[model samples]
Target chain A: MTDPKRPRDPDPLADDAFDAALGARLRAGREDTATLSAAVLSRLAQDPRQTPPGRWLTPAPMAAGFAGLMTVAGVAGYLWVPLFGAGGEDAILAAALGGLVPGGF
Target chain B: MTAEARAKGASEAMDALMRGDRLALSRLIALYGPGIRAFAAHQLGDASEAEDIAQEVFLRVWSEARRYDPARGAVSTWIWRIAANLCTDRRRRRAVRRFLGLEAVPEAALPDDAMPGAERIVAGREQMRQLGPALAALPDRQREALLMRTAGELATAEIAAAMGLSPGAVEQLLVRARAGLRRTMGEKDDD
Candidate 1:
């Protein structure tokens, strides 16, 4: 473990004072955070916490949903090919005229 | 307050929060909010985004109280980890927005206009003028380590836990970060 007291830099230009001053400046920013704290608390009051979501939204469920969707699309495509493929004259006519005609062609 | 007192308070607040005392959330916020905001502002160079990250961090604490494992680390460490992760995520989103032309590239210097009144005064100082961009220019890990130490009040070991780095690595990063900032600020002076 690196000892916090040990000087790691041999460079004469390394200004430990400057770094400490910078750290102080950074810490100085802390005083102005009352507005932030109030804002957070106000937001907390506005939005009540809900129970944590279980594994319902995990990748496994998402993947299963995708598989279900793909299965649906595949079944649709399989049925669609038999009706609307190049050999299905009636299917093509019906698709072309179905919207315009009261009954499908 | 002393560090020990602050840690004890934070621990008590976390326990209260876990016990469904919503008011304890305010105490936790009062304790950790400033450090998280400071760390986020310095790391992202955007005050508005820093506020958002700070708010989100507390919200997560409220909603995810069950996830807190005291055996692993202190409440401060856990909260700092949340803040750091949110800042990292926000920075990544900013980069993606820039890449997609939805957001402009951030200026090297900090945005004084968007900064809070006090931060503006600090940024307005002549010597401190270049510090922001010099800080922004440091390597991401180095900047994160330094900000956690300075702004987040995280010890080397706490930073290591938050950042998933060894304590030695965190110390090296701090050393290099200060060196890099000095060089960059010096160059700005030369120019």
Candidate 2:
């Protein structure tokens, strides 16, 4: 939306003088040299931009993928790792029973 | 985007800000942050208070950035208006504290060296101290109008919009602000 009240440009001399006054104020706002302003800039840069350290096991995407893989691995481990002493390929077949049941022999 | 990029860049940045892009928000903060800080610092006569106000201003920007529309004014102007409003609010609160005879004012005004690094803050503070008397001597309206205009680098139009005055009034205020500033600094021209 338009502001509907933007100022008309000032006359040339007025504009120049205005600029000069402002320049002084801005320059005056400047402090020391080189690494002068630790206070304000430090404060300004304190936003959470990216790669936030601490908390959560991973970025949410990776964590979700990891959880899925871990679940599948846990199921495979349970089937193959001799539950009730049902070791070896028998256990493997039982674990794989969801598919490839190979009809009538 | 340079000027070459500013149009495309600003448009994209505007969209990014609306979409809550953190980087865009940071850019917007940087664009107008210093001006806001300066205005706050000058208004409160203390850098610590100014920094506090600056952070508040940015937080408000982060929250309200989605509402900003580039067609109205540059993001810079829009943000400064927010900052100015916040500073004015704080000034009111300060007045209340002072009235209660309970607010213990700081011994010396904080220096504007609130920016990062330790470079020239001392010199800057010295200048502020040297100019403090001069700055205090001006009529309130002239001082505020000059500081708000120059420190923010606001064009007269944006200044008018922020101050709620006619552009003609702004021009008059600005002219008086400059003359007052020159007189405050003990400068005189033959012409």
Candidate 3:
């Protein structure tokens, strides 16, 4: 229930003019020529379309697909390979078991 | 690519960026930097600082785009926050300078009106100096709520998305922020 017509407090943004002035000064300097600013921008864009490395590649499905492939490859290697001791001291069961369920000697 | 296709192409480009496509990042900047700079100019309130801040924001965006989560916020809002954060940091640095007594008050902001140009700037300066504390005193959410409302020209829904507030909450925040500003500025009274 405050007075709608009275000066509410003192205008917190009354100094918006100061920010406006700062904006004005900055723009005034640019008014003479846009060439320098343009050049500066161009310098920043020296490699206009060159993407830097380690960025997320938008074709994200490829990265996902690659991950899937790695997973499959690992499982296949586990299932298909004959990774066992040539000197058969109960090696077949041992390799198949992979350090699990000790083979009876 | 047609216009829609071009945008789709850009979406793919962003994906490529996500895929570690080094050039996509640069392409994205080339496409969006100017617009970002223009917005930054207005948002930061000065071009000299705006340019540097814009560059810093974009670099941070590039470095962190991978962390962007749609569930958390819109990509645009994420970028906006980077820019806003940089501006706020600059403000903090300036405040620190002023705090150490190293910040000299510009003569134009002083009370004495000796010269015409100085006199003009003085009024503006004095008004701002007076207003600064009040503006600073406002709740951060209220102040940022106002900035979000004005700067982005965003609808309440969009503001809600960017700020992670409910739309209703955003509207209420805006109401309070405006009322707060009005109260602080003495809009209820005049000299």
Candidate 4:
């Protein structure tokens, strides 16, 4: 834990006078407030916030959705290939030849 | 007005803004423009770019107002966070530009002659000339923490929230920034 009061580094401008002087100097160089405000307001008026409700459907979500779809397809293929052979040709023939077996009575 | 009252007013304004009230946005800019501009100018060391960044920050607020949750923090904190992020983006873009040799590195603009008084203006300009290099020498986060603390008059907790750091971390950044400035200024004074 760092001590709040510890003088880790000596600050020559630790006094209030230096703080005030620095603040004033920075403020003096500041851009005109009214001008900046007007520019901001004008820009805001020109390009009003038109964020759509579906803005959250960004690329990440889209990519995730695609991956999920691919995973489901892959899982279905894996199950199907094992249950019905690589092309399911034998299963198709068996279903079509139902009751036409050579030894059927 | 008390801090509570000011915050209440800001909350109301934000609510109005979320409800598509342009007047609320104008009011927000009126209230927070100077501080935002100062933060940008100090961080970027360029007045024109600061103005551009300030404009971008408010535009973002207008767009993102509905996402704001007052329970999380004040409107000022939200706004400063946007300003800081935009300034960082601009700095990164400027770096890329300079790396590609497409643009020269920008120097902080000297104080304009249109400043009201002559004598005081000259002295302030000299002070800023000294202060600019000292400020530019500090690391980005340290410079940012110090400027937001001092120029923006933001509380430590508010700054921490804006910078996504703990209050203690923000204080340490401030300390280091001040120490770095003092050393740089001392070196300048010696030469």
Candidate 5:
């Protein structure tokens, strides 16, 4: 005899049958993985993104250096007018040289 | 291998993949390729597209292996989530293309002449012919939950995570999906 307090298994047979049929049909839809995997690996090999991690590091430091140089140049250009008093080429040159040499001004 | 052993192996394989090990990726493909393909095939209704989706899923896996956290879930769950999202994105793109009057090329018809003795293929095509419309008629979330449950063989909790739903919501979606499928298929709702 089944336990009275136990929860009933609802739609047991029907659910199982439906799921089994569905799973079987889906399995039948399977494709050839070897060819697919080969294609995927080939694409991966060609993709530069998949290159070794440090392969990107080589360009990264160079990019950083270039960015740093640009930032310094930008700061210098911003301070050029203020320091040189917006006068002539001689003042600009003097300001630049003064900034480079400590207490030269 | 036991489930524990398999999980450990998968985790190790993922670590190796993150470290740029191609053999580990090959192992992963051998392990999870069929499940991904089947899920994509059922969801998209096109074998070639399914193959493409499967490959894309693995490529994403290879690219994003560093982001995988075993503490969050199993590796299979992570991979299936990627597959599910890719399938959803493809469907959405197709819909948008249709809306924009960009005529998407129709999937090529399967060549019936290729395999005369493949009884499973014959039977599956017939079943899909009868069932495809009903399956497609389901709401996207319900259909995804149902397919991940039935075809992907994922547990409810895993489905919830993949669908970004609470477990309770996932159960409700699944129940509604089953009822909808049964009603459309003309099955008696005895339960």
Candidate 6:
């Protein structure tokens, strides 16, 4: 696999030796998966929680959609306020502020 | 089993798994589990993490079967690409934990209290013990490339496709990885 013309090429023999050594070490470290296999297979069989850990929410798309919705809602609310009379504006402000106070709005 | 036979078995298992056959999923796990585990173990320096990866890989294979395109690559290649991606995510999370001081640096290998000093000095065992830290010391990409090559038993082209790199780039990575490992191991880099 080594080409002398290629600057990336090191000594071919040494590379092979390194690979062999690494491969051996990896093989030795290989996990015995009988118990894991059983657990995983049973989980698949029972259809326990399809999503992997920490991936259940899929936050990006949801967060983007939420932000878009909030922006549009804010813009729409701002635009609609001008059409409302001063009384309506006061009513809206009171309605919004009421929720911030203690007890039911 | 021959590579041909193994590939054939994995393909059949994948097909069955897509049909919702749990037994076929088990077979697929049996086929690729060791490699995925070894790949993860070497990458994360932890067996428990490796087990998590192996289990997750199978679950992913079960769920994402429809997304698989046989024309793109072999079954092993597809499975390994998933494993490689999971390993990347895991390593990143591990790094973040370390950065936040939420994690302490754990020993790379479990201490074998049963093995006496003389027995621990055996050449292969000693070399294997040394490798954990040496591998951990490697830069992420270099370590990943080497682990995928060695532990995943992936061809360079398969690795390239998995890593979204050209075959030439994969070759360069492999060469650099080997050189890095050599340097870490106190071997002659010129050699």
lDDT of 3 by residue, A29-57 (tens): 22222332344345446753444332333
Q: Write the per-residue lDDT of candidate 6 for residues A1-105, one digit (tens) a residue.
A: 788777663577876677866775676535355666897978876774488755533446569879999999999998888897797799888998999999837
Give me the runs in candidate 3 sitting further than 4 Å from their true place: A1-105, B1-13, B16-47, B104-139, B164-168, B182-191
List chain B TM-scores, each candidate: 0.87, 0.81, 0.56, 0.90, 0.83, 0.84
Q: Is candidate 2 or candidate 4 better by DockQ?
A: 4
Q: Tens-digit lDDT track for model 3 on B1-191?
A: 13345345546666786776656655555444444454444444455555566566556665676887756755556666666666666666656778998865332111212224865656645664554444445676665655554433345675677667899997777767666765766852463
TM-score of each: 0.73, 0.60, 0.44, 0.73, 0.69, 0.76
Residue-level lDDT tens digits of model 2 in B116-165: 56766766566666555555566665666766666666677777777777
**Which residue pairs clash in candidate 5?**
none
Query: Residue-wise lDDT of candidate 5 within A1-105, one digit each (tens)?
Result: 999999776685787677667755655545345766787789888983664343234445669979999999999888776764657567878878999897889
Candidate 2 error regions (>4 Å): A1-18, A21-105, B1-12, B107-122, B187-191
lDDT of 5 by residue, B78-102 (tens): 9989998788777766777789989
Model 6 docking category: acceptable
What level of docking quality does candidate 1 show?
acceptable
- Estimate the lDDT of model 1: 0.75
Best-matching candidate per TM-score: 6
Instruction: Compose the digit string of candidate 6's lDDT tens values, residues B108-187.
Output: 74322323465553654566577777788887777777887787667788788777889998888888777677677776
lDDT tens readout by residue for model 2, A1-105: 757698755477866775665556554544332222333334446753322132132346568879899999999887766755655756557667845666622
Q: Judged by DockQ cut-offs, is candidate 5 incorrect, acceptable, medium or high?
A: incorrect
Tens-place lDDT digits, model 1, residues B49-143 = 77778778888898899889999998988998888877776776677778899997554333333346865666554434567778888999999
| Cα error, candidate 3, residue B81 (Å) | 2.0
DockQ of each: 0.28, 0.08, 0.03, 0.25, 0.20, 0.36
Predicted structure with the largest lDDT when compared to the true one: 4
> Residue B22: error of model 3 in Å?
8.7
Error of 5 at B51 (Å): 1.5
Local distance difference test, per candidate? 0.75, 0.62, 0.54, 0.76, 0.74, 0.76
Off by over 4 Å in 5: A1-9, A12-17, A48-105, B1-9, B104-118, B187-191
